[model samples]
Target: MKKTEEKIIRFIDAHKLIEKGERVLVAFSGGPDSVFALHFLKKFQKKYKIELAAVHFNHQLRGKEAETDEKFAKEFCGKLEVEFFSAKLNVKKLANSKKLSIEEAARKLRYQNLEKLCKQNSFSKIATAHNLSDNTETVLMNLLSGTSAAGLSGIPVVRGNIIRPVLCVTKQEILEYLEKNRIAFRIDSSNLSDDFKRNFLRNRILPLLRGKINPALDEAVYRTTSNLKSQLTVNERVVNHFINEFTRKKANGFEIRLNIAEVFGEIPGELLKVLIEKNFDYEFKHEDYAKINSLAKNHKGKKVNLGSGITVIREKELLCFQKEESSLTGEVEFPAGKKAKLCGVTVFIQKAEIEANPAKKKAYELISADELDEKFLLRTWKHGDIFKPLGFKGTKKVSDFLTDAKIPASEKKNRLVLLNRNKIIWVVGLRISDEVKITNKTKRVYKLWTI
Candidate 1:
């Protein structure tokens, strides 16, 4: 074997990228890197005792050029006698409709297709030909785009069932091997056009760097990135211990009770990013760590809202975080002659006399005080807190009302529940109670709500 092939084989063997009697799915784009991957797997199939298959996604952006690539891949697979699958996608239309960039939309669709094939065909591995150069580009992109340590760590060699056997190689090395072996592959015309960010890196920036600076910059960066990935893995394992100890669980969300920085103290920025992403799925602001680090040590009851619908509450020396999707506070409004629900709270407006004003205002709905219940109480949501809604004899819990009505978290606390002593009379913004319906005895019509 040639030196490059030996290096790739050794890397794969070291990581167990391929296993004996295993089924592997190849991400075959018919590009040089992917083609090299195909050849490498072919060379190792007998020795590894593995079954390899190819899946090609035609993004349909390059028109005939894309079609030619797909045809080439199919024919090449046939010549190799490998099982091949292909899909046609309208990536441009989907991206435009979703308001996503062309690259993102295509990537999502491609992965979805590949996963479908893998699951259905019983393939345990999906291999992509992402080489070292790609990782450097990604790291640079993340840095330029305000990336954290995880971003700086660059692309992962293996994530779940997805494996990159050629991650240690580069575009130049793959091209050299393909040339020496007389391998043929189709070019993606769009790649040559600088319409995408990756393309900008590959075509414009890489050449400039190689010409002006170090020719081996990609390898140098790759070496640094490989080390970072190892450290990140360890940090992630450690952070999960904190997550298990301190995070609170909810039916619809979670709350974190401990400040992250206090315990770990100076965790690598990359590890911090990973922990935050695991909880919130987003990177922090530039000053997030500094602020968090300070607050963890000095203050109590400070609040921070990390995205992914998660909120952090600092109170009583406990830093609590919860997903924003669920709310503990609820609302209720009792309309005169009506029932309104504020999440788990219920209210009824009955016989209240609210007078009409000369100003003729529009926002508030008023009713007579007589329509309201004599007493009302707002409390936590409980199971089987049932009430008979208007137009129905059947009763249901206040718990069911908020969920059924789809009340938003922000509005839950703000909703008012009108009540008659212990019984709920109305749920604001929803139904009024039959018991609270205004009669002609009501001399005044009460305004029940206001904007």
Candidate 2:
């Protein structure tokens, strides 16, 4: 076996990234690293009896150059007698739509397409050409971007079904092997542009660091990353056990309730971080972790919203991670004598002559139509909003009233308030303004009901 092939095989064996006879899909971009990966994997395929296939994704950034790269990849795969698949993505459009950087968008799209291709073809493993230099660059990026120990550990060799076989080799080695074999590969012009952060690191920063600080920096970082991965594995097992013991599936299995006092008391923050990330597949922000630590230390009824409809509420004894219910539609216009759907409630207003029943409170409030000067507006309760309760003497802040009524904070935003000419008339589903209350002498009434 050649030296490069031996290195790759050793890494694959150590990581258990592949098994004999498993159909593997290679992400071939016709670049040096990917070309070398395809070459080495094809060479090793005969020994392991594994079926090899190649996939190419054109990011549609380099215009005609991208088409040429796709052609090169397809022709190369044809020459190797392997099945080739090609996909095109408008990366700029994707990035603009998703509000992601070009690099991030391209990566996400490539991986998504690769995963779909693997599933469609029944391939067990998806191989990528990430090399040792890639890992070092990632570690540096993570550090510069406020990362933890896990981030410092660098990218995993085996992440789910995606395997990086060339992570064991360097970019220099891949280039050397490709040159030694006289293999032709296309160069991506975008990679040479240092406008992107990764490119800036790869071209300018890393090369300078390699020349001045440490020539063997990549190997040293790789060793540290490998050690951290081992430590992380042990930590993950312990954290998962803690999570399982303290948490119960809730909300039709959409959420989990964790006994914070029992499980996380005196526990390290790192374990808690891993617990949430590993189980929920969500990364907690810095403030979120701080709030969690506060929950453990103080055991107060505090809440932290982790975005994406996910909220973490810290009760006295338990912490609940729940998917919040969608709130009512924002600000709906409610003209008098007209029924309109607002906040998932059909609000109706009509001037009616009705007898007041003393025994039963009206399902819909009967308000004197003359009292309302402008159209009723249904919207969320805002800060500094004041309204008089049906029988109250003085005005009360809507927030204080909700707090007194023990309305959970998560549901407050969905609480609808009916306003007349910017005046609070009703806290919908709760109470109506005293000014709009029907009286014994009332003849003309405006009926307001949410169905």
Candidate 3:
């Protein structure tokens, strides 16, 4: 075997990533790394008795460049008697629709295609040419974006069905191999563009670090990340403990009390978010943690607004967290001589005489500057959580109201009901009681909210 081929075999053999006679789908982007990877893997295929194929995803960003890459990859595979498959994806459209970055969209699309292709073709393993430089860039990018220890630990060399046989090699070594072997490959122009966060790191920050610090900065950082990953092994145990203690199941899915702000002090806030998302597939933004942390020092009963209609209730001893079932904005209305709560606003309404402003922050609704309420019903809609829908004298299942509202299944359990003396005044963001809507005979207005 050639030196490069021997190195590739040794790396994979050390990891035991590929079995003898296994079929492999190699992710070939037609770049130097992937092209050299394809060349070397083909060299070793006969000895291992492994069948090799190339899979390419055209992200449609570089227009003809993707097509050029695909054609080149196909021809290269064809010349070597290897199977080739290619797909085109609308990466930009996917990114825009999902509100994700272009890099994220392209990555997600590429992986999905790889996964689908492997499933269809019965390939047991997928190989990529991510190298040590890639690992360093990944760790740096994650750190700049406030990643946890897990993120700093760098990319895994082997992840399940995916294997990076070229991970031990550096980008410079791959280039050297391509030059020495007289190999042809296409360059992705997007890598030169600074618009992407990763490109910025790769082009600007990485070079500065290399020039200013150690010349072998990539290896240094990779080692640092490995040590950090090993060091944080103990933190995972404590994280699991907090994850279990704070989470609970309600009627719907679950809620996390998140009172462990004191228990896991040194851990980055991102880990807390990870724990929540890992357990419940739910989370708040980074700044939301700052808000929650501030509340930890304040008095109890302080409420916080979490997005997607969720609310964190900071209690004296524990935080009682739940979802708000209504729109964060918009209005609720009530009429003459009746009591109600604007279901969406979570505020109560009563008919009274003309006087004050109607819009107030907490637990109050629109009446007229004229028709105001003296008393009203206040609660969230519950499953057996009943609500008397407006214009109807009878109460319906709060679950039914949610169904009619088309509330997402994940959020169904969180809708709160506002009841006045056991009568449904409002369903909170859905419908208010008909008896309390503004009428021609309304008289007053009353308002409330703390400045």
The number of clashing residue pairs in each candidate reads 54, 0, 27
**TM-score of every model versus the real structure:** 0.66, 0.70, 0.67
Question: Cα lDDT of model 2 overall?
Answer: 0.79
TM-score of 2: 0.70
- Model 2, range 1-451, lDDT digits (tens) per residue? 6898888888889888889999999999999999999988888788778999999999988889999999999999999999999999889997786566788788878988998998899999999999999999999988887766788899788888999988988898889999999999999988998988888999999999889999988998999999999998897787778666666666412223444445445545565566566546355455566766665555445777664456776544456666656555588786787876765677777777775454366576767666676477888888888999888999999998987776755456668888887888889878888987777766567777889
lDDT of 3 by residue, 304-397 (tens): 7654445665554554445544453222333334444333332433334543454434344443333223344344454466656776777777
State the lDDT at 366 in candidate 1.
Answer: 41
lDDT of 3 at 255: 48
| Cα lDDT, model 1, residue 199 | 85
Off by over 4 Å in 3: 1-4, 249-253, 265-273, 276-451
In the predicted model 2, the residue pairs found to clash are: none
Measured by TM-score, the strongest candidate is 2
- Candidate 1 C-alpha lDDT tens digits along 1-451: 7899899988998988888999999999999989999889988899889999999999988878888899999999999998999999889987786566788778878888888899999999999999988887988887776766677888787888999999989888999999998999988777788977878987899889988998998888988887888887787787667767766555434544544546655433444454565656344554665555554554544566654455655554454445565455654433335555444444443443344343444433343345444345544445555666666677777656765776544233445545555666556556555555445576655445522
- lDDT by candidate, in order shown: 0.71, 0.79, 0.69
